[model samples]
Target: MEASPTLKEQVSILEEQVGTYETVKSSLIEIEEESDVTEEDFSGITFYSDASVKLYDIDSAYINQLLGTYAIVRMSEKN
Candidate 1:
């Protein structure tokens, strides 16, 4: 059996996967300016942004939540 990653480890891995940290940060700031999300709304949430984003092995419920919140311009499956 394999052990699951800790929350900190998951966050670190997500950060590495989303290399454009500054770009994502700026985009989040812009989103905050345009939307009703406050700093408290962002607590314990991770933001990943890129020109062409790819998310692997994510939970369907979480994906649906993201889609509900943000506009996904493009998406495709690979398997």
Candidate 2:
């Protein structure tokens, strides 16, 4: 039988994954900024779906708040 990873090993794996995610997120933000996309342009972006419920059709203010929270958390991880 294969041995499961220890607690420390699992933590190390998770940390690596987080680091990779942060790097990708940072790169995406940099690209968007360099592309001269305005905040309104970014926020107005939407996804189209044939389903009964459309996510983008919901309250945009809440979506912006969530995005702001995610940016803050990502920034905090740098320290």
Candidate 3:
């Protein structure tokens, strides 16, 4: 049988969310603010000379939980 993830493993996964946020936050392209995201953007979108923005498929609810975007539950998926 497969083993469940240990506490250390779970913590590592949680830590990765912070790294992901920082990486995107520091990027020059402000995806939603600068350009409209299309279905293609979800695959891979490029801008200007060299920046490429690809939307990775992570669960929106998980992201909301990680970022703590609300007082209770997720506000909306409209973003």
Among these predictions, the greatest TM-score belongs to 2
Better of 1 and 2 by lDDT: 2
Clash numbers, per candidate: 0, 0, 0
Candidate 2's error at 71, in angstroms?
0.6
**Whole-model Cα lDDT of every candidate shown, in order:** 0.70, 0.80, 0.70
TM-score of each: 0.19, 0.29, 0.20
Count backbone overlaps in model 1. Answer: 0
lDDT of 2 at 4: 60
The alpha-carbon lDDT assigned to residue 70 of candidate 1 equals 58
Residues 1-79 of candidate 3: C-alpha lDDT, one tens digit per residue: 7656797698788797997878877896655656566555444654454346566799988988878856444556543
Worst 10 residues of 3 by lDDT: 41-50
Off by over 4 Å in 1: 1-55, 71-79
Best by lDDT: 2
At residue 54, candidate 2 shows an lDDT of 50
Q: How high is the lDDT of residue 40 in model 1?
A: 68
- Candidate 2 deviant stretches above 4 angstroms: 1-56
RMSD of 3: 22.3
- Compose the digit string of candidate 1's lDDT tens values, residues 1-79: 6656787799888889786876777778643256666556556797777946876898999989888655544333221
How far does residue 38 in candidate 3 sit from its true spot (Å)?
23
